[model samples]
Target chain A: MTAVVTGDLPVIEAPRSRRSGGGNGTNFEMYAWIFMRMSGLLLVFLVLGHLFIMLLLDGGVQRINFGFVAGRWASPFWRTWDLAQLWLAQLHGTNGLRVIINDYAERDGTRFWLKMLLYTSSFLVLLLGTLVIFTFDPDITG
Target chain B: MQAPAGTLYRGREGMWSWVAHRVTGVLIFFFLFAHVLDTALVRVSPDSYNRIMDTYKTPLVNLMEVGLVGAVLFHALNGLRVMAIDFWEKGTRYQKQMTWAVLTVFVAVMVPATYRMVAHTFAELFGSTT
Candidate 1:
């Protein structure tokens, strides 16, 4: 190995968690931290129940169809349940991914662009999902 | 005696759990996007929605459903473990044990769930209707 110049060596930085003043003085990170755990707790129930009914009971995946969905959405409680799920899961996951992007994307430009794509996709998903849940017509074809 | 040079987080259960949580979280997020899109098909037409759902009923995809369930369950369990580490006073000290507990619970849930899913798949593939 050749001797390296001291000036050419990259500076070793501590990980984000160890840094005391990593964030921009705003409480955004703190809020993000809180949101993750809270939404995570809620999703444990909402998603598991959804999975159990749609993927495990009444013949599992085979029994699920448009009619199955229609039946579920027929009730206001189920509608509210789905709407809450859509919001919480989408926001929770979006924030989780945002943290990941912040951690991995070292370059400023790369981080900005990655977050743009993430935010865009997540926004569309939230919008589309909310619309579907609210405007779902069981007899659309009829 | 262990050397003090190497990082503690690397090659340890804590790092692995964090890594696993990240990976599964990313994957599940992508799946959620698709799930929303597909569910939106209900507003399109009944026949169109049902036709799209037929793809999910395939045996190959059925196996992936088992894997998805495993990933989801693991993520959920490990999230709780993370919370414990953050909130509980004894959490950091017992994090290794908590990691093991997470795996134990994951396996406990997955075993029976996997068996049930596999059995259902086989019956759907080979069972004859009388």
Candidate 2:
């Protein structure tokens, strides 16, 4: 197979995983791109439903309190719904920022640090959020 | 190193749209951070959660909510536009059209929502007894 060259500069193509950044042995960028699309679609429903229920529905924000939340969490449906929302939104938005940092940050050190921070914070939030959703006890009388 | 200049405004609609998408995306992400943190307060204590939420009921916070809604709606619609561009064969050729379509939908959805959100705040501030 012949290589096609379009630009003046000589081009050398590397392995997809290598070129895509310090990823594990996988087509991570392709998966990341696909994840963005899929998660964005899911997030539209999850987020809109959340906003509608939390801010725009019957009694609206005025009705939200600890009891309201405890009641909602009492149901498995809302627990799962909120869990999905937190995971999907956090992952999707974090990946978007990763792409942005990749595009804009000029230096390798800067990119590395930025991603380290991003991944660290994203992990913490996701962990904290998931734990909170599942382990919340409404009847802790004190 | 060359200093960055102000030619960002001169980019095509696609570039500008991408810029706006990135901006809105970042805004939503930060908001989500705060949102989750506040929501997590429910686990900590009911009074703390309710107190934090009550602060969000102010007119100032309500106005910010309108802005948040605009950001989220625009990001969602434009995200679809971006997905099309990435996945569809013909998407690149008609990106401008897709962007315009996104903007149209954004305005259509956001206007009524903004009106309702803001109007409710105004009504609450002025009292329903008037």
Candidate 3:
């Protein structure tokens, strides 16, 4: 039987409510937490740059009609940027919601259902978004 | 024994920081939701896409853009602070200092960005020669 002690501090076991089972050895939550911060930092730039260009440039939001979008998507650079933004934002928001659900939902069933809904919707949005970004056809006619 | 409910939160910077982070996170989520739908419009005809976007060209929306910038900036800086706390052993001890540093950087970044966003929008709407 190995001990749970670390240095001089008392060995505190993981909480029963924690789905992560930290005391059992998995570090999934730790990695998720780290991903949140890393993705958040990158999103700061990708999202801000997107907002600046789309909402505050020469013509501003007024100029962002179909033609403008079509013209922009014609370049692979914008497509990649948009795709990255879509994935990051969806994953970040979904994971945040998952954490909140785990923290707040008192019952196991409720928490499971809430996360199910969150995951389903997140998946749908990501799939739809990826499709739109890559399969956009600029020359479609009536 | 617990402090009274009214005074429970007194002198707690971490509590306020937690609140701010959650608020910003929610705000960003909603914005992204709408943004994805709007950008998906590009898959449709340009005319249809532009027609929808035409409504966004207003002073009110421009003001909201400033708010979005504030939320994003705060969330990003605080998120870095969170990372520090997670990875650095001394992070917990200096959390308050880190919070202040985050706020300082937020102000530094937002002030200029806000000025540019609002000023440029005003120039566009009212046609400033300068």
Candidate 4:
């Protein structure tokens, strides 16, 4: 408000905007938003196909067991499919729940702690799932 | 408290679809957390893994699987509607229609899928493999 030109219609300084970038000049939220769409598009295929085979195809849930998993994972195709699915689904779900927490969890500390727990659990799932896919023992039935 | 002037979303098909999307997404996310854990059980003894999976094959749990398939199918279909709304030039103009289209496709896919899954559950529970 201080600086003004001599006669140029009383120049005024612009006030700061009410809205701000995520406090850090990075498009993190934008990326997360886009990631939801991208991963969601892929997951429609991965997950539904998975559901079809696991829940609708042959004998469905009745035939699912350790031997079935070992048989499926024996193929590289299924291994990669499950691996990609595990990663994409967890990350997509993590970002999604994070947004939900931000919206519904009114308290600042509550949101923070809930998100910490979410990240911890998501990380554990990802780690454990990846390991299982890689080191699956097809002969565990023996 | 009130949108006296007007609003784009107006609590109709669009708003309800948004609500369903969020609810199903959260539900599916929680399920996925548990699903990964169950799949990981294979790394343990087969006895432990198959023992748990035996529970999944039961009657009540199979019904839940039907519900799960419905939820996932809805989420996947409506997600495409969202993509259309976000990316297509005429999406906003036809969004309500697209929502209907999503549901139509959802039911179309769900009917046969549900039948097949339920048939399997019946056959398994009654000891007639087909």
Measured by DockQ, the strongest candidate is 1
Write candidate 4's Cα lDDT for A1-142 as tens digits. 2333243353334665545445677779889989999999999999999998988887888898888887898899999999999999899989989999999999999999999999999989999999999999877753
TM-score of each: 0.89, 0.85, 0.80, 0.89
Tens digits of per-residue lDDT for model 2, B3-84: 3334322467888898899999999999999988998887777788989989888889988888888888888888888888
Error of 1 at B90 (Å): 0.4
Question: Which scores better on TM-score, 2 or 4?
Answer: 4
- Per-model fnat list: 0.63, 0.44, 0.44, 0.69
Sorted on DockQ, best first, the list reads 1, 4, 3, 2
Model 3, span A19-95: residue lDDT tens: 44335577788789878887887887898798778756775665667777788989999999999999998999989
lDDT of each: 0.87, 0.85, 0.80, 0.88
Q: List the residue pairs that clash in candidate 1.
A: none
Can you list each candidate's DockQ? 0.42, 0.35, 0.36, 0.40
Expressed as tens digits, the lDDT of each residue in A44-102 for candidate 2 is 89898888777777656767888999999999999999999999999999998999999
Question: Which docking class does model 1 fall in?
Answer: acceptable
- For every model in order, the TM-score on chain A comes to 0.83, 0.81, 0.82, 0.84
Chain A vs. native, model 1, TM-score:
0.83
Error of 3 at B120 (Å): 5.3
Instruction: Please list the residue runs of candidate 3 whose C-alpha ends up more than 4 Å from where it truly belongs after superposition.
Output: A1-27, B4-11, B120-130
